[model samples]
Target: MDKIERIEIAVIGAGLGGAAAAALLDDAGFVAHTFEQAPGFDRLGAGIHIGPNVMKVFRQIGLEDELARIGSHPSHWFSRDGTTGEYLSEIPLGDYALKEYGAPYITIHRGDMHATQIARLDKSRLHFGFRLSDIVEQDDGVLLTFENGRKVLAGLVIGADGINSVIREKLLGAERPRFSGWIGHRALVDMNKLRSTGLDYERCVKWWWEQSRHIMAYATKSDGSEYYYVTGVPVDSWEHSESFVDSSREEMDAIFGGSHPMVQGLIDATESVTKWPFWNRDPMGLWSRGRLVMLGDACHPMRPHMAQGAGMAIEDAAVLTRCLTMTGVQDYATAFQLYENTRRARATKVQTISNANTWLKDPEDPAWVYAYDPMNVELN
Candidate 1:
């Protein structure tokens, strides 16, 4: 038998959530090692919204100011009619967010944000190319086997591995995620072409059509040079084997052609686009079992309609770290329970609202979502 390495804590998956978990755990003075199946990550063509709720978590990890500097701070979240170009709602978020929500709200390229996160982690403990192949519950800890033939004994395992998490499968058995009968077309439009239309694009806007079909567009940079959009459209089914399929401007025109001039401009500027099927799973009855626990998409996967999917995941990391700090690692069961108790209600609420696709469609107070402070929230 190969000599198995022993770690105080193991975090699977080095994506946004897992990276946050590892960083928070480290900040809490815990010796947590992060393992990623992939050799490394890239600056993929994607963007994300960081609300004040999870920005507090980033603040704890010393990332808030840096991220705020790199991202676009939209004055409001504007929901507009797709065809008429009339504003349905405008929720204040710039200075108002700073005053009311206790932090800044920004939209940034996902890759840029993720790269910033990965850079702050302790590199020696962050292992790459270690795909989790098997796990065995033991008397002292969980024995983890990687596809690379490396073995480890982790005192506690956090499955931040995402919707197709292997640790989730270990807890609930193998089950594929359910398709939500929706697909999102994501693209970064050509800025020059968009500018040629001579129409001022809002920093952040969601153009809505019938049946809740819409395109959420925004700037992904501080200078407003890079713009991105993701559209939600109902579909019968997803038969593709790959994660996403190539899309084109022609397809954009076919679906959203002859709408508002601004909408028309976005379609005309589309250079490259891809369509992805949204996958979901009902909130699980189990968040932790034995020495194994889960966070982020591993436990509560939801649609991106509310743009809180990553926010919720990062919030989980903060709460979970605090719970462990309160109880200590030896009392992990109690800590895990506290983490779940504190997080379940809020996470489930976001999941339900996001799936309904009705958040910020009309004027309403978003205080509950944006004002949350995961770092300071009382642990249950």
Candidate 2:
């Protein structure tokens, strides 16, 4: 029997990327287990927009109908001047989005999306609170040592952990997730309040862009709630800068102070605001080291400017699944190489776009990251 013949795959992290990978591996008949460092599943700040490319992957995972039911399809995307709040340009969504990309664009609260992924998974496959502390790849398989002293052995280990991935430390050395010097302040507000105020929430993702800052807001989770995410670019910070997570509301206010009223109003509406320090990694020449491999942020962490963080991760899962299903590939190293070859270029492009200065949202750049077809493209 060969290593790839009947393998047990272990995935770290339970965020969008990890969950998606687990689902794909399970569907492929691989014995897959997931280890999430968090003790329990909790929703993040607000909604996440899923473009046609990612939606297509969800469809392949058999969650398209459920995702459609739970997600809201916006009609357009609006860009506005950060200072005066003047409209710059608008991009049509929904039918137009579908027509252009072959799949509809949908936005849902992070919690709802998490729920949708959860519904498709078997309860026994995911292990919450399994924090990975160290990983060692051997000739036969990889051994994962958790912070709590529990260990798991598998033929393949995938690091789907977010910016701060422990599995990455083992494979790629102790590399830190660099800060983009931009802090994201996010919140979920009641849709009823937004509607009473007569704000057009459904037209598109509204962006109020200033010289060095931007506010992005959209209706999400059944159109009953609005999710707002703001990024305040810092003046002087390079890669590998320090950041503060779970930032206080006062700190958030201070950062956005003197900005647009619309942006301030959204911040005021949020009672307990959380801040995420953005980070990204340049495209590495290698995404796989051996039986141990990198997945999602572990391989290529990027800023959320183009909203491709989750989408790229989903794409990785799809292609990784494809590599695993290749017949006659008995050697795990060969399979790993194939997976890296197929994903490196695409993932690098995404990382490059995301790492760019998106605070300078160029109207000429039509966000090509959202338009990708996994089925048609040869990753290798």
Candidate 3:
């Protein structure tokens, strides 16, 4: 048996949600440690929209200004017809988001934002290359066994480990996430090639087609140096064993060719592209069991259509931290209950709409989502 180390809180999976949870918990004066499986991270080719809702949380953690400085502040989230370039809707952002939603909305490189999050964490408490392999719940605490021959007894555990969370499996049993019949092709376009078309691409836009197939494109930087896009296409099934597979410009043309000039320009700019299958799980009946609890994708995995998946996870981190602060680690059950009460309905609503892929497809008020202040919201 490995020597049993002890900790107050153990947060598994240092992804967006896990990192946020660890940060918020530490800020609230809790001794929390974050464990990640990967030895390190890479600057992957992907983009994410950070809604004002989540920016508020980032503000609480003191990262709002740095992120705002690094990310692109689009004037609006434009939805347009893929073939005709006809405007379907233009939802206000930029200054409008700052004034109305209590924070700024920005589209940024997912890797850049993630690196920023990881950088802000306490170095001593953040552990890399620690893959969680087994969990044992006890009366006073929980035992965590990592594959690296490390053992830890944590008073409380937060499973921000994502959809395939080992902690989640311990609670709900071993089951694979169901494929949502959707795959997204992600790519970062060659900026020079894109500019050669001489057509101005909006800072943030979603090109829509029939059957809900579309590409969400936006700049990842404030200076517009990096542009990225992710496409959602329905498929019969995902047979590939790898998480993602390579795709080519010809494949893109075959699927979205002869559309609008701008759409054609994007294909021409595509140098390297990869396609990934989206996996999902239904709304869980259990968000926590004893000292083990879950947040983000572990509790409510959804499609990324709404662009609020990470936002929800970060929000969960904030709220969970608040709950723990209220009840203290000794009363973890009450804290867990409050966390679920505060998060469930909202998370479920977002999950439902995200799976439908209808958010922001038409002009409508997004205040309910973008305006929510998780840091100050009343805990149930």
lDDT of each: 0.91, 0.74, 0.90
Q: Model 2 over residues 293-367: C-alpha lDDT tens digits? A: 777888888888777788888888888877787732246567778778877887787788778855236454344
* Ranking of predictions according to lDDT: 1, 3, 2
lDDT of 3: 0.90
**Count of backbone clashes, every candidate in sequence:** 0, 4, 0
Q: What's each prediction's TM-score?
A: 0.98, 0.88, 0.98
Clashes of 3: 0
> What TM-score would candidate 2 get against the native?
0.88
Q: Residue by residue across 119-229, what tens digits does model 3's lDDT show? A: 999999999999999999897789999999999999999999998999899999999999999999999875677898775556665656544588878888888877888
The runs of at least 3 residues in candidate 1 whose Cα sits more than 4 Å from the true structure, single-residue gaps closed, are none
TM-score of predicted structure 1: 0.98
RMSD each, Å = 1.1, 3.9, 1.0
For candidate 3, list the clashing residue pairs, or say none.
none
